[model samples]
Target: MTAYEYKVVPAPAKGERARGIKGTEARFSHSLERVMNDMAADGWEYQRAETLPSDERSGLASTVTVWRNVLVFRRGKAGDVAAYQPRKLDAPKPYVLTTPLAEAVHDQQTATGTSDPDQPLAHPMNTLVALPVASTAPPETPRLGETPEVARTARVAATDNGVEETQDLHQMSSILRDRAARLIAAEQPGRS
Candidate 1:
């Protein structure tokens, strides 16, 4: 929670004269502006103007209630903390898929040595496949401060079930990826 300090001061009684500024209302507004500006320069925020009643003796025994105009201002205290401000979430990245599904599946199958589906490829997930791409640019250079990617074949997810189960799941994913690619390819025109 934030703590604030408040200050109350009397409003200007009269406006200061200025060239080309004519009218009682305009002059009064100018006077108020002067007070507000002065307060602002001192790091005070103008809150509101109030008309407060004060009782004072008019004569020997007569008492009268008089209305007084005062300006209110407030500022954050030295030890005050700022209000909670939630951080904005970053925008989600879009998936950019360019290749026609059938073509991509064919390429992936060829690279993974799964082009002949009759026989299973040994260590399918262990082998890295480099698909044909149009870009002639030399392989990307690692950006500054970016950690180098760990070789996929050497990386394994440690799970409660032994490493063999993890390898089985990994191989299953590779099979699914290939199946999904082929299914998508079968939907494309001119693909068997």
Candidate 2:
């Protein structure tokens, strides 16, 4: 196992806002850089800055939050430099689940001769063939004073050639909506 140590420092003070001498402000602000370099030379690496807030009572029945910026640095545990070296970890094992309903479905498919014993069942609505069906019936002439763009066309079949299967687009969309809801629910953290 690896361990780390942290250091917290108050945010660097800014140079004087009033103009006086050229580069004086930059020179004054460089104090923070000097301190950081000095820490780095001692094996500390700069991490990040954070703003901490605390509520303080200002007057009776009122409270104010005071925010303070802090700079953070971290380093490995003392005398344990080897713990920081990168090492490979074994891959996680795959999860296997068995359910009664799944077995029932497999048995029913085998009994009905609808699926091969070695092959998995295929869902009919999972794959849809979308083809533009040419209209053989005579097209209806547009009514008087009606623009051609306003004329509605027949719906094309969403199936393979010469197949009489009908798939409900609304049902497919609802299934997708339900799956998305399940995924969103799984992503939320549980309360303690």
Candidate 3:
């Protein structure tokens, strides 16, 4: 049997309770819970869980935040590994809204270098853009730029320099033919 190790953070306290507002706090808690449930549903068993303390500044705040971690494990036969794949959950779509105040603030900041130093640093918003989704089906053909013939030729050429020299001669002939074709095309343009 093949052993597979996985980690997951189970749903936090917020998800267990019916919270009126689905704010950032609720989302964070829900994310943790979803990860745990998803892993458990995939045959993974909980191995461990721990709470990570917040930094000194944050720890002293009125509402302290701590990281909740969970680890899970699973085992399967080598042949069964491929068939045990689970479907991935769809990512939440982004909603766009215009903010006149935000736009004005941004414009002012651009005009004057002076801005709120206490505010969080501006990050590249596009960094969070979702990557092109991939299909679950296995690829039908080898990936692009991967040629078995070229690979074999390269291997043979490396081991046998004499074969490489012969291959170079054939390549030279092809190059010469290409150059001749270009020259003929250039000359025929004048006739046209």
Q: Which candidate wins on TM-score? A: 1
Highest lDDT scorer: 1
lDDT of 2 by residue, 78-101 (tens): 978788678889999986435654
Off by over 4 Å in 1: 81-192
Tens digit per residue, CA lDDT, model 1, 19-120: 788998898889888889999999899899999999999989999999999999998886654454566899999875555644655566788767775566
Question: Residue 12's C-alpha lDDT in candidate 1?
Answer: 87
Task: Write candidate 3's Cα lDDT for 14-83 as tens digits.
Answer: 4433456477777766766666677779767666665565533444555655665445445454466655
lDDT of 2: 0.70
Candidate 2 at residue 118, lDDT? 66
Count of residue pairs whose backbone atoms collide, per candidate: 0, 0, 1
Instruction: State every prediction's TM-score relative to the real structure.
Output: 0.45, 0.35, 0.22
Q: What is the C-alpha RMSD of each candidate to the true structure, in Å?
A: 26.6, 27.5, 30.7
Please report how far candidate 2 places residue 21 from its true position, in Å: 8.2
Give the runs in model 3 whose Cα sits over 4 Å from its true position. 17-37, 54-192
Clashing pairs in 1: none
